[model samples]
Target: MAVFWIQPATFLAAYYHYFHGYGELIASHAADPSYEVALPGLCQPLRIRDFPSFLVDTTGGEVGKLVNDAFRELFEFMDEQGHGAKFLVNTFDELEPAALAAMRRYLDVFAIGPLVGSSAEARIHLFDHAGADKKRYMEWLGAQPDMSVVYVSFGSIWTYSKQQMEEIAQGLRQCGRPYLLVVRKDGRQEDVSSCLDDAVLKGQGMVVEWCDQPAVLAHPSVGCFVTHCGWNSTLEAMALGVPVVAAPSMFDQPTNAYLIEQCVAGVRGERNGNGVFAGAELARCVELVMGSGARAVEIREGVEALKGMAREAAVSGGRADRNLRSFVTDTTIH
Candidate 1:
């Protein structure tokens, strides 16, 4: 019947970033022979190495459960299928050939990349509205010099505990740079302001619940981006030619971080043991990236190169374009 299974990028990406914590546990289970009988095809019995990290976590509370469920639901579907279905992950062949290979037996699998690119483009257009929101981001950017401000955001889903938030503030305080932090207003205002309670951050830091991201990144003052390594955010940063401090909270973030830091030389942040980092570490990462003289220059130049490459990739005969075309063709073919 050819049931084509699609892996959600949001789900898979989350798995790539946070899977660090659960690897050992999953690996252990994979070593046990009993796993095959206990969970049947589910593979939880195998070990930590075989499973994504989310399944092994106990710390994120309900949010952790939600993450667990995301992966769970996908596997559950596979288990229910009589012969299973073809699986398609929302990724690029260049990015994750190994995982695609491993899952091939489960079903026919293909990787299509950066699906959120168009979505981000759509969001970018939304900034065209000339209203209070645009004015705030623009005016703020206007006041700063070129490449002077650091734009910091945690993507749409990452939420910090109160203590973590304060630590971030302290780190920003220590960095001694002009910054804008976009944090959701969920009773976390106190934690956000604790570091600035005195005049240490006067006229240096601004906190907004949300801001026009594309506008902010395009601003002359925005020298670097501190981000969660979400594909959309990463692409936007690259498109805007801003170096990224890739602090990936979970999922494909680690993979993304590897690309940015190792391949592109445009990122400067390390994932901690569990794929999560402390606020102090985040601060150090930011300082190294934002305050870096030579590294910053290299990053800016590298970003410019990527922008050129992105343009070529979009052209009719460009590598990216062809890859995209092949992606579509693969998805449609038998």
Candidate 2:
């Protein structure tokens, strides 16, 4: 009798407690041995190499400490588990067949999503729009030519230093492309209008504090996503048939970026360290990607193809949706 675990990715404190102490924190109250617990598997194991480009520097600042400690805890827990537990990951078999296949030896791995499909049923209405403001964004987008606007957002978590942020802004300005920027309320928000020259701001760009992302992507003008490569964002972007410029900053972002740009054709962006892409290099890369209408066309077509596949996987009778239901049944059945 296997019982599934349900933990939110946002609940890092709990993750730290369970993983860092090897269940010693929870074992006192646990009904059975910790080895009997089933865990949620990631698309890949957390690794120093795979840490967000920012976290790779152990000698770096606070964010590094946070990233390092969290992953350290996670791996430590995995090491203590004795390979006796079943693991289920909410990913698709198609997205990472190799990693999933390798994981099968160590755990009863099941890839059961694009979990956004579940978000629709939550009654949260978190992603839905209000009224006029929503329509204004959407209508502005609708007026633009197809694939004209580049959507730029770092996932809710990551923040950029002012210098780094402006460099990106400069790059975008230099690229001479229309963009929608999501300036999350990190401390980094400054007078960016000063940095961008008049020519660059000629009614071409819009910056919003937060947006209903799923709705925005569904808009006709959103051609590509310049993203941090969060798995949820990746899935959502793919679901919208939008190709990506994967500017991943932290966490599993690099892993997701690699999957898109290297493994799949729908993503393009930078890699840092190991003789890959850096910030300036990434700027160049972004320019090259956005400059080419042909490449954009290719990415759009590829995303559309991927979207069709994702739709089938999440639709009522498909393998992914059915597997998710089956897993729930098996775990919940008496």
Candidate 3:
């Protein structure tokens, strides 16, 4: 009955009956209650308003009702179950100490990840990029100056509208920096390259259908990431010491984005009334993160500190390893 989940622990808490004998791994930073607490160094507490329209209820429309109904069912299931479940979160102690501590008050929680493959043999990419020319991309990256290129991708899912894509294109042009933008062939209506001429993209940027994200982020040329703030992407960027420009859209992305911004490791782009972003706003966020000013320096410092912590946690005999071993021992004993 061992289960690995990316959803909130509340959903896991509801289905404890399914995991009576074995353990469950819940991968997230904040629990349901921790979101309510005023984070120590954050500018403001995270609220429902911070979430995208699909996740929160500000306007009373049919779509909003459907979203609310689904959430209501989820919580109702948890409430009826009556007790909380222990969690093995895909986060480390140093990253979210307060949220982890707060969750521990209610459940037996352990922090044991940046949960990525340590060896090349263990790497498992869900998306097939066998056709991609890794050497070519790496060579391009190698030619660029250290900490000079912006890497942009929004994960595998969550398609952006053509308008949104255009805005991002325009924003990148405005930033006037070297970039590698991964636009999924299936996610957009028109070819992104067609919209932006060869002159704007050829020397200044590289647009690929897909590429090895970790490799790109780890490259010395990648100074900042324009990300959707998915937990895996967030952790990877942190581990690599790459500052972020968060353009979170839905799910736990908003929470991750808030945390990144609060920790001074990134800046969040402003979403318009419809949760869409303008090119100007995106440019502003990118400039803020990529600039050599005081705030950017602070962000780089924070990301570097987190990167060290992530490396230490993943090493043998580190805190995460010890915690994982303890979990295994306890499970075997029982």
Q: Sorted by TM-score, highest first, which candidate order results?
A: 3, 2, 1
lDDT of 2: 0.59
In model 1, the runs with Cα more than 4 Å from the true position are 1-26, 29-52, 55-112, 115-121, 124-132, 187-200, 266-280, 292-294, 315-333
Off by over 4 Å in 3: 1-44, 50-55, 58-84, 118-121, 191-193, 198-202
Kindly indicate the candidate among 2 and 3 with the higher TM-score.
3
lDDT of 3 by residue, 1-334 (tens): 2224453332232223113321121212223323342333333554443433344433456875675466556545544544343467788878777666655554556678767654433677667776888788889999999999989898988676867788888888888899898877676766555555542566899888788888888899999999888888888898889999988776567767767876778998777867677778878888888887898899999999999999999889998898788777766765
> lDDT of candidate 3?
0.70
Which candidate gets the maximum lDDT versus the true structure? 3
* lDDT per residue as tens, model 2, 184-289: 5452456554544432487788776567788788878776787877888888887778778887655566656656754344554645454333456545655545
Q: TM-score for candidate 1, please give it.
A: 0.65
- Cα miss at 91, model 2 (Å)? 1.4
Clashes of each: 21, 0, 0
After superposition, the stretches of candidate 2 with alpha carbons farther than 4 Å from their true spots are 1-57, 60-84, 117-132, 187-193, 196-200, 266-268, 271-283, 287-298, 332-334
